[model samples]
Target: MADERETRPQADRQLCGLVRDLASQIEAHLRTRAATLGLTPTQATALCELTHPMTLRELADRMSCEPSNITFVADRLEGQGYLERHPHPDDRRAKQLLLTPEGSELRGRLVELLSKDSPLAPLATEEQDGLRHLLTRALIR
Candidate 1:
């Protein structure tokens, strides 16, 4: 029991480090693609996530951010004609965000760019599947 507890912290630290490294690589790749389309990483993320119209609060929740932050992103996107704010059907004072045609086109391009190559391109298909399974299982736990 003592040995298990002692090794657990080390194992956690290693796992965290690996995850951070992988995230950094993925972020860098995404940032490059976003820049080509004149978008900040957050803006690109927002565009990709808005597959359907959603309230500002819902978007904020999905992005794991504050509502005010989402409002700022939405304002910028609206100014760029990439999105629009429409009155929510159920709430007189609330609004929902919908991507414009331009936004959808750009989002499609962004998806293409992001999907061009896997970050783990060096790994075989089987290895990639195994890694994905392991990661999913860990996340579920």
Candidate 2:
């Protein structure tokens, strides 16, 4: 118990470092998987976060990026016939982004690729759930 007390103060710093390392691994894995589909990392990330039709602002918030960056990514995806913009249901001036059939297909493939050999793959299902729970709790200010 004495040793545990001595180490407790350093645990938060160590945990933060581990989280950063995990994020880096996940980003690298995403980049590699995205490349196989001819997508830039940002575009792939946007699509992954777009599982439902949502406004640019909503998607941007989910992506933790400025709406302007998503605007450009949306344009590229639209030009490629992967997505379409529609007027939001109750908002007069906002547009919601929806996946086209091609976009849905690509998103499916991307999800499949992401699931394989992912950074959390080594964790058992329950352990993964525990980690997610802890992280979400940490985020709830």
Candidate 3:
């Protein structure tokens, strides 16, 4: 009763700290991995998430950024010949971003690098799954 209430705040603060530390480690890992492929973390993330052609608006939604932000990413990728923008078939007002062949190859290598030496590499498969489930459950609440 009173005992539980007294510890709950401390427990929550500790959990929040742990989560932040983990997030920092993961971001560092992503930065390192993306650098190996000559990409910024955001660019690498965009490339990896582009399984199919999508408009800037859609990419922004996936990357959790504003559509304007995605334009900069798309411009850099397009300049490097990693992707191209074509008029959207369904939307006359929007353009779809498609990965070039080179982009696909780069993304494959990027994925491989990202899969190795992950911040959570120490966790076993079941532990990772459990953590993911818990995180997902928490997010929904």
The top-ranked prediction according to lDDT is: 2
1-141 per-residue lDDT for model 3 (tens digits): 998998999999999999999999988999999998889999999998899999998999999999999999999999999999999998899899999999999989998898898988899999999999999998895
Q: Could you say which candidate leads in TM-score?
A: 3
TM-score, candidate number 1: 0.84
Cα error, residue 130 of model 2, in Å, equals: 0.3
User: How much lDDT does candidate 1 score?
Assistant: 0.91
Regions more than 4 Å wrong, model 1: 1-3, 120-141
Q: Order the candidate numbers by TM-score, best to worst.
A: 3, 2, 1
Q: Which portions of model 3 miss their true places by more than 4 Å?
A: none
Backbone steric clashes in candidate 2, count: 0
Worst 10 residues of 2 by lDDT: 4-13
TM-score of 3: 0.94
List lDDT for all candidates, in order. Answer: 0.91, 0.95, 0.94
Clashes of each: 0, 0, 0
**What's model 1's lDDT at 3?**
100
Question: What's each prediction's TM-score?
Answer: 0.84, 0.93, 0.94
Provide the lowest-lDDT 10-residue window in model 3: 111-120
